[model samples]
Target: MKWSKSSRTLRRIFTKSSIGQNPTSKGKWGTSLTSHRNKLGTSRVISTELSPSSRRFTRRMPFHHNKSKKEPNGILHRSQAYVAFIDETFKGTKRVPRFMDDNNIVKGREAQRWIVDTALEMADAVRHTLGPKGMDMMLVDRMGNKVLTNDGATILKSLETKDPVASIIAEVAKSQEQNAFDGTTTCIVIMGELLRRADELISRGVHPNAIIKGYRMGLSQAIAWSEEISEEKEAYEAGVEAAKTAITGKSAEDFVDILSDICSRAAMVSSPSEMMLLTVHGKPEDAELIEGLVVLKGPATAGMPTKAAGNIALIESEMAPPQAQVSLTDPDQIKEIVAIQQAFLDEIVARLVKAEVKVVFCQKNIDSKMLQLLRKNDILAFRNVRRNDILKMVHALGGQLIADFADFSKSDMSAATVEVVESAVNDYVVVRGDGIKAASIVMPAPTEQSGEEFQRALEDAVGVSYLAVQNKKMVKGAGTIQAQMSYRLLSGEGCATADNSKVEAARRAFAEALLIIPQTLAESAGMDLMDVTVKLGNSPGLGVNVHDMVLEEMNVFEPLAVVQSAMSGAVENGVSLLRTHSIIMAKPIQEIFAEAERR
Candidate 1:
């Protein structure tokens, strides 16, 4: 080969003829021969032809760098080669890699799909527990304890997975539980449906933002339609209906008639913040509503009157002797302290007696001497009552809570008829008289598990009933509002135009998603889902009655607030999840610590 002054051969040139023949054999290389100028203004060419044994050594020399040429496909090509070379040159030293590496992060479509799938899994876990005919789930903990529940919030909260989408769904369910208290399953089911539809539209080339906007539009129409279709009823009537809806599927279903009246009466008498629940061990049939408050504790002493009718006093201060800061070493000093404490007790009793206070609720302990004094005065007293109970008593009887005995007066007391009900297991103080403002539910459960479930059921009932009374609105349930909302959103004529096709697709998807509630209801009740949903789509005010599988105007009613809140919350959360384009999971603490130790 002749060396030209205009170019430099970085490696000895090899042609096909040169492989086995003489080194000077002239063989024109094929199209693989190329030339490029280096940064130093020198022309360079790298051409090689070799046998299998020497092919590993054929690498592009540093002087022949070409930006326009594409790298050949192989493990040892281009960037891979650079990485391998760096690793070989610094084999013993540590080099920090990219953040989260590639394995720990999911981006773009994959991340969105993973989130949608995870959310759907969580939603499905609770979907089977939707509506009145929904089934219950048995949750067993690591210690072998079990809970059977159909409450969506309970089921979602019981899920022990670490998936982020599941966590978000759980949080949304928790919010639903706190706000409306009876629509967690509805909220989660709607969220899953929205995400499913949104994913579909995204696959069909619709933008996520367009889907989100359509969801907002659907939510606005739903809220408007809900308010328009709601019925106005008296507090007690609404409470009765709401309570029935809340209790239909629980273990307390056998007591529906009895509990509905009790819950309604409870809500009618007192506000949600003022009403109290007292659970006792007995049959569910034994549950009753008390016209006034009942404390689980009895009078402080046996000699005190079991029943009295006079003024009720709520004392926040302790009726015991003050703690002596100075320790006494002599009997004389101790006796003096005792006499002073007795005088203090006598003064407290005299004050109560003079004020005509018949009942006393103390937030702190009462000294033994004070109990005897109160007994002599024909007054009933309870000591060490919880602060919450004291507040309830105050709110119930319209009395002031006095923290200082010196501040106690006739003005601080309220009139009440007090009675001590003695039982084999416990004693209760029932206070009922004129001007009493609070109501109490005395619930009897046969077992601890049943008691907890009963409480959960009542909590939902009371919360929704109270909200109904506050909002003064009730919507038809059993997927009535959902079907109507879906139809109205899809009825827009402009949604079919080409200029707004993306938005139109999104609107149509959201409309379809809204029917998932009705579909799930039909499925749960063993009805023909397709037939029921199609009929529901045509009928405006009619809803499926799960008992008969008939599409008609059923008497199921839910609070308007619950319906609107569930729809809005579900859509907002679904839009939020759709906007998430990437997810990067952090390394476990153990792995981080190990890596640090190695460093």
Candidate 2:
């Protein structure tokens, strides 16, 4: 074959002939002759022909390249020019891979490890701040929103990263949130510290197994310590102390006595059968007194006495049964039940209209029908009386039962001469006639606008105070005798008196306070596990290794930007950093170390 190239195209020319003996063959292929033809000036082609059968047997091979393509599947390698350039400029080094890929990256579990380590390192950096004096974290979100908080869960949750391991740490924070409403911050700090310690252990070449064993032993002791600390007697004392601390911060003189009095009242009133009473309206000068402990549902009206003086009627229930117990399960049942209840309620209204009963309290539903009837009869019937209100009402009135259409003659009316004194400042009425002066309080209100604000404030104060005390004790590693007692008393599982409702409330408060310590410890330990293990044990040659060391190295391998990004992602996903810290921190250091040793 001969070929020639032109400006537009290339051309080829061929010359060949075959000769045969047969007449047809002789005419077309008998002669073996060669002919040269001009193709595009100088191009020539040599041709070889095959028979039809030969052609049918021939096959073409697929094309293959000797060298792999620089780019595969349209994806650029981490070492690619653009990637390397960007990484160098932003990361200040090209040693680390820019993207996740098999050749130049850690992915899957390995990637997760890197993330976990990085997060633990950050946690350790703040571990010292585990107590009430703990430090705060300043976080800036992707949108430039800034948050400053000492909450561990908040910090962990705020972290965003593509690393799966780091995400696991974030999960620890979530666990803490569920276990302990507070202490997320302490947990996170503890986790970070543990990891840091683990890294030191690793450097010392201590076997991971030994560290793991130690950690397990320590955890066992810690759990036992928690149990010991939370004894009932101790818990009560702690509760008293906590209350004193809170009150004293607000007032310095004999705050302990005042708190003790309040606690006594709580113990007395907190009963499932009765309402707890707390008085919160006192004269400005008497505000420091903090007396008249009654649990009422709503706030003191515009102007009311914070302290209750005089005798109190402690009614345990609503003065009347529900007009109806309407069942939503069946439509017909609802109407029939309501009608029946209304009929019974009408009789009670009739009696009240006769002026036999001055104030009436009821639990459960008071149908619209009953309301209209009572309004028409000029009988004030308050429905859904809270536990606190019941106690107060019972205290004020001598606990009498007025049934349907029961007419009290002049003698009966005069016999029960507790006059109702309406307070202009509070939502309760004081019963003061017949030389009987008593206050009525309520518990949870039926309506949203009724009494939630005061309840929430009290709950918050109690919850925070409890957490503070627990954190303090855990930091000291002291036996938690107080915590145990508080838990039993407050959880309503102990052998406490059943009648006094106030005592029950106090018990619950104590339990809440005792619960804070262990929860915080568990969360903080978990967080530190990954890092602490690494510090304590040398890298495992082949078997299981400490999570702490693993986490530390992983963090060292990851860039700060990745860490920050992962945290941001976590927060955007609605994961709370505070919660994450609590969970990670809650893991006992001993447990992690023990696991390491076993490995």
Candidate 3:
């Protein structure tokens, strides 16, 4: 009965050996704030009717710091510890404390439907914005910054709602975005239809428990059905298909194949590759891949050539004056220290010159003297290189990382084809060689805002495609997979023969819920649902042609993992709300303290 939210556990830790034997012994007692009790006495938390006005008492026990090693548990004061003491005194029997309080309660079907309805209220706004024809939502926050997007997570999160149930639903959409990386809108739409079907069954006198059980049954069948119909393509093919499907409802509809191809290439060469966006005074359609690793830094000094090709030397150590790193407290030795530092730098430059090394990449700082020495030796050097870039460079240039400045072994040096190119405002170092396995896709937009938006969309496409390749599974998109799963569960072949009415009910409800995706797709595209349905009939390849407003087989597809993630998230959330009968708002600790002192 002693509940604590910090660690998320409520347990009784008895301070004294015996409660009845310790009546004269001064100590604290356990406390239970809720009035709800299980009929079978098996539930951790239960639903029972009690007046919210009922005042329950709780004692504030003093926790003194006991330094003694023998006294493990701290001392407790038994001031106003009646409720838990009485409950413990009569542990087995129903002779419990009388002051349990309840705050929010709705009895029977009303409670079941009301919670689902409240959750769906948030889902309603985002469900319509699913599929290719989905409309964008413009959200203006308190600061009045307008964000225009069709992203389900964005729309749900941007809404300012005070209802707690509504927040829970919003959390589900957000969770989908975080976990699956896409399908935020599809998840909301699916769960909304799930509750709608559950409500429908409840109106027909179906028990809420039956509907919950049936929903589970239907979910299992839907998952199995989806698993069966999933079709996979080669890495590039699958990536292109997945990428195209992801951008269906997005603003870059015209460049679907072009975007998909770039994402596919990036995914194939670089698993989780870095995307670089450059905003030029050009159209977004001019996006293309660079056949080299993008090192955003320019050449270290103007004395270094803009382009050079030779054996590379990668130094993980600093190029600064070695004597500067040491301390010289005496003023008289300052000139001596400077001469020693200059000599130290002179040796490093001499070694590079002897080894015939062309370009030098240093992880740490380069002193001005060392820069001059390198330039004097006709060797190009870049300073303060990023660690990731350094690693990629080693992999690309086929070079070894030199940790010691004194060792200039020929084995440590490798080949590097370096070019310092000037873009609109900044310079970039493009490092490429035969050994590099990755590629960089650079896209330029007409404006900074448009370029950034395209970059974000491209990132989503690339991420999903990479995941699809790694997972090795996919499902037909354009609402085809959802349609198949829907038909499978609703056909009565998936769940009717189980002889359990509850499972049958859940299966039916689940099957009906799967139609939400295709239904929304049809609505968004302004096509007749019946007409689209007839066109896609039983063919796994056939999907809605969003562009031409016809049903045709196209490359629209999605990762199987994406659909699976959305299904699991939606079912878990819907069932959690379905099982609830009441919502409780606990009184503040001060109110309980006031009541305890009065007692």
Candidate 4:
């Protein structure tokens, strides 16, 4: 519920936000307090204060009244204030109209200005990381670890902050990343602009409700425009170009053609959320897409064959030495115990060999003795495998996982193929079958750190490119779709069969906000913003050629679903922030006095 202009300022403080999100604190709390005294010499500061159980604010606004009897300037005599005309049973106390409490209050302009400005500053931080010519952000952690990349998700997640507003902005970035994985920077930019435009409207004597209404209308039209334009025509290699656009921001620029081909092939056999990301230590050009699962670990022994194609045995439990249960009082007893355990382990291997299983995947570590036995028998045993990877391998091969040696029989085996190839990078195992539904996009980097950056970029590109293929179309990129939506929204030529001039102020604000993407791209690339915007006329296929600085059709494209998702998330973030008239900070009793210990 919204509080009135004169309502008391928000009460209490807490470690959590209203959206139920917990931000990474970076070992610090982000809080700002403002206060002032009224002309009557009483404080009306906006800060935290202790309250008794009865005075604590609840979910509903608290009623503060009936503490005084006399009206101001003696306007009401005793008879008028008493109201003796009503019957005794019908009498009820009234809350007299009052200004903000002498203790707490937050004005509209003050709250709106700061929140909008803070959001804009965050947007600016990521603005330069958009489009082909965008630059990367070199993020250094507290331990002096360096990460150099232009991926929006990487940049936002790498830096942690304690401020509530920054936390909320992080949520916006996360939503964009999880939903589409493309257009994260675009979504954040639009959200900040929405708030910026909203602040201007509030300053221009417009009600917040009106601004909200107009924004909703504009958002609806933006989504509709995105859907209507659908996909760009497949004139020539459109799919390749769209995939390239998704990974163009310097992270994969050196070999986007090969990366695009690999991403497209991986998408054919993998689910969007289940796609695997594998990083190997080598050159960037060694990237490959396997139509199967990568265990991320190699065989247990170097003597084992690098390639194995036969019945597979998937072990879910550890393949280690026996766990001694009885205390040995003499050396003879200990020797007997060790001999018995060794025989039992040998029998398990013998069973696999009899079942014609040539390869084994152990979920847990394998003892060195067992590895030597498997190597001598020409069996490829992959040890220390992750549980998730084990599950994927079993599912891909259409086999059942056996947790115990007794439970593993001929029925548990499945026909499969596995390869342990050695490249300039580390050795990794690839498991495949006749009908596998998983795939891995492997990228080789000069160092482990750069490999991480490449993996991040591939993840973003894969999701968006897959979405475009699923939606059956794409829109011309390089600011083409946004420019069309802006013209349609502001010129009043679309969005209805009737006039929408009543909310023109809000609609105009939204339209101008759409241009920020193209304008920012131009300025970052050292080109004239006005010239770029003019070249990006109110046409569907018209977009700026970033390299040539000319206005023409480049056949560039991105998924429509990405744009729609970004718009939905950005608007939701902006509207929620706008509806917040005051922030109620809540803190626990212990934390209230946590600092006193240090004193």
Candidate 5:
């Protein structure tokens, strides 16, 4: 029943009770309980005060047992009692019963504070590794493998954290790295600074909604100002500058010119999709770019020729013979099966020889017998090649990938020159001939860790170069663009509806938040942050020269996509973090698994 109707019914039932009637009208000092109940009838008036017996009646009725039947002694039905109790006790309040432990739940301002703090802590881990003067961090995994670098994405991904907020920040940094290719640290630092400003605003009683609105306005204005200040340079010049800017603060810093040349040339020939990395054992100065496919694997057998110049073939299946469906119990049947397998191998080798195929790349392993046959034919074959490598080689060498060895023919082959060069660590097979559009950068380093680090640097360099070439737009780096964005935001040059004080406060906070990048750069370079930020703020084309700890006209330019990508990601994630009002930490999955196993 509806609460209003149930309430009226309850009131009538109470009025008809003996205790609700006038005591004087009853006239008997000691009336029997049965007589009193029999005389109970509907009355217009209800007793303002409840009697002891009526109180006992209400207390004995359990609100939870609302589906039960009516009881004796004129007690109302359980549903009516339940409705009346609910309407009288909690009509306007929003309080709910506690079903979760207080320790695992963080609510209201406390949850917001926790989120901001956790994100800031994660950002701090990569804060110092921001600019040319930035320091590197040594990350050691559980297996005792160490990685020493200043790359923001590397540091964030390598660190272990249980906090969900930290994970979210790390994911945002990773997204920036993937999309912009060179702004992970800048993204995280901007996000952290945004959160810091938001925390301050919240302490002063500003609503988070106002903060989100202000941040959105600030992001649009920053993007617009960035576009206005961007300069278009030739693809080659921009590619070289972008590469040098990307490789400024890593182990490859000393070889920035050489690496930049390699990166620019590779990017000019082909986009990042057609580029690859080949690591070798040597010094960083020995790095070079090859205008062909480079496979780290060599010939499958020692007896095969290490170098061959002829048509190329790609195989997707293994070269081993297929098994017979039935068991061979008789010696004649076994011999027949062996002969069929031998015939299969011989047919494959003969087909390759007929096609004049001298270089073969297979996706799966080749049988020992097949390897011997190819060696006798003087064909260079590499077995167990990766599927990606096979596809790349097909694209670079103008060959078709054959699904089955039985289907191989002269039409599927393409002419190419292949050679296996032995290095200190391993052998590399270089394929250079027809259809050589793709290029690979052969990077050299002394140790495995250093090689890996150099590889990361080369990746960023290549990525930035490709972006710069594709976009053809560049901006001044080293805090110049950030300073300009901050100045424009605070000046309210484009914002027409900047009226409300709370939103204005939030907008100002956003403007200040963007200055964190320049501030960080100045601090890392051992210059006065205020002085450097002031100089850059006044000058449009001047940037921080970390080597000399002075503000000068910097020739360093970064791709416009990098700056825009980082700002957009930081603002979006920062607003998302601020909108969170509650955090419920669930039990760890490992603990849940343990409980399930025990059960």
Candidate 6:
């Protein structure tokens, strides 16, 4: 009765059969018939026919079925057709998969090798510019910007490089800057020396691990020695010694005097706790002679005389009375507050009149009423003096508050005493003249805005001095000696109080020196450290170029299997070079890596 459905279901099951299964079974027939009946509907019935060849066949043909002679394509057979169509559509296209292209692959092992080599190269470039007698590098930027300085960090930072290895060298240079704040050249030279030593080991077929081990040992010793060298009992003494060391065999007395004077000035103005002075309207040259420190208590806008010769009367407070705080949130509040504070201000003016204080410095804004009162009392008052100027003015005022009001008189004016005198320019006061006047040269006070620039200049001068000393030692030339003398100045001794700075500087110098080794090797490897630096400096997109160059030049073998392997090679080579050579070679190498990584 349902033989047609059964026979159709059997055909479906046999078509789906794989390698193993029973060809005929009653249970299979039952299951097949049920599945076919459920899909085709219960009303559909199977019909059977015996062909001319006596083969029995079942057919369940609905009204929609044609029951044609052609056989249906099997599920597996249709799948094959679909796959063929898809394959044809995408044939001969540029969609082939690959792993080692510029966009995807990073030849890390090659980069590591290049980095190590470039580090050594850079270290060697500045090797001679080390120690107290180190030479300077004249850096010229791409825009033809010229910088004549011996600071190792400055020189390395300024150079253009593209090698990944060179960037690593630059890091070492930066490390020097951070560690020493000075003697960057020494650090780079030391790095170069170490790198050279590492190269020697590599050439000799020594295991990189062994070389790295030896280098680490040497670095440990060098670091200890560096710490010892930087250790100082007294800041002033250390400053003097550093100066002498910086200028040895060339105007010894002048160098000592100059250093001492700077130390003294730093101590006086910056406080004995810190050996650095910030001037808003003065230069280092102005503080050449020890005239005690002063704090001018006035407005920041008030201009002081560039040079004033005579006994100076240093006023600790403004010539004008203390200003009363007034809320000017409302426009009308200004007039009312000014009127209300006028009476109290007049009484303070009376004291200044009696004291005959000529120049007064105010820490607050000057109201019209106070200005009028001061004018009537014939007192000159300046407002908003900077902190540095306040210190200088207090020292010049003979330690007296001009106003003598309770609020203004609270500051310690003992340190504000000054020598007052009449000068050709104007009536002036010197903070602590000691009766000595050497052509008063007025200059703008040092302020936060200009302090960094001035400090850079000072650092450059020091670097130049270092270079001159180095030149003398290297070539024994009279020109170098003369140059040293030209820059030399007399200063006092045991005046500085910056112990931490000296120690830090020493530490940095040693660290920097240690970094120069690998840089030299990078240079030897023909890596263009400058190009790498320039690309990194200009744009991050150029990092690809840097990475490519590193891989092309530094990889020892083809088809690096993993990135870690390359990284290990680089680190090992870099560390080994640093240990064996001076940092002079290391500076460039460190710089190269720094540029590439944007570090």
Q: Judging by lDDT against the true structure, name the best candidate.
A: 5
What digit string (tens of lDDT, one per residue) describes model 2 on residues 82-144? 110111112111122123222334334323223335545555544433433234556788898
lDDT string, candidate 1, 39-136, tens digits: 43223333444333323222232322233432342111132111111111121212121123435566788678777776776788888888878999
RMSD of 3: 14.1
Candidate 3 collision pairs: 214-506, 215-506, 312-414
Q: Per-candidate TM vs. native?
A: 0.74, 0.35, 0.64, 0.77, 0.77, 0.38
- Descending-TM-score candidate ranking: 4, 5, 1, 3, 6, 2
Residue runs of model 1 more than 4 Å from their true location after superposition = 1-107, 140-145, 158-165, 324-329, 470-472, 493-499, 538-542, 549-553, 582-599
Give each model's clash number: 0, 151, 3, 7, 0, 142
**Ranking of models by lDDT:** 5, 1, 4, 3, 6, 2
Encode model 4's per-residue lDDT on 1-599: one tens digit a residue.
11111133233222212122121111112222233333533222233222332122211112222335324542222221111111111112111111334545444665576577667767877888988889888999889988898887777776587556667888889888988878889999999899988987888887777787788888898888778877654422444555788888666788899998887766656766667888878777878888887767777878889999999888988886668567778999888888988998799889989999899988888888889889988999988788887777776677899888876788888887889877654778887778778888888888787788788888887877676555657777788788888878766676752245436688778877888887777777788877776666545356767788665776778878788888788888898888877543456668878967768
Worst ten-residue run, lDDT, model 3? 85-94
Residue 382's lDDT within candidate 4 is: 88
RMSD of each: 16.2, 25.1, 14.1, 13.9, 17.3, 25.8
Worst 10 residues of 5 by lDDT: 31-40
Better of 1 and 3 by TM-score: 1
lDDT of 5 by residue, 1-599 (tens): 11123431233222323332322232122211211111222111222223333321111111222223434434444233221122222212122111233355657876787777666767777889999999999999899988899999999988797667878888998898889888999999899889978988999999999999888877887898899889999999999999999999999999999999999889988777677897888988989898877888978989788888989888898878887579667999899889999999999889899998888888999999889988888988999998988988777767788997756689899888888888878788888885688888999888888899999998999999999998889999998888878877777667544577888888788888888888898898899987876776677457888889888887888999999999999999999989988777777899999999999
Model with the higher lDDT, candidate 2 or 3: 3
Instruction: Please identify model 2 stretches exceeding 4 Å from their true place.
Output: 1-115, 118-184, 199-209, 220-237, 243-369, 375-599
Instruction: After superposing candidate 6 on the true structure, give the runs of residues whose Cα lies further than 4 Å from its correct spot.
Output: 1-109, 124-146, 157-181, 199-209, 220-241, 248-273, 276-415, 418-599
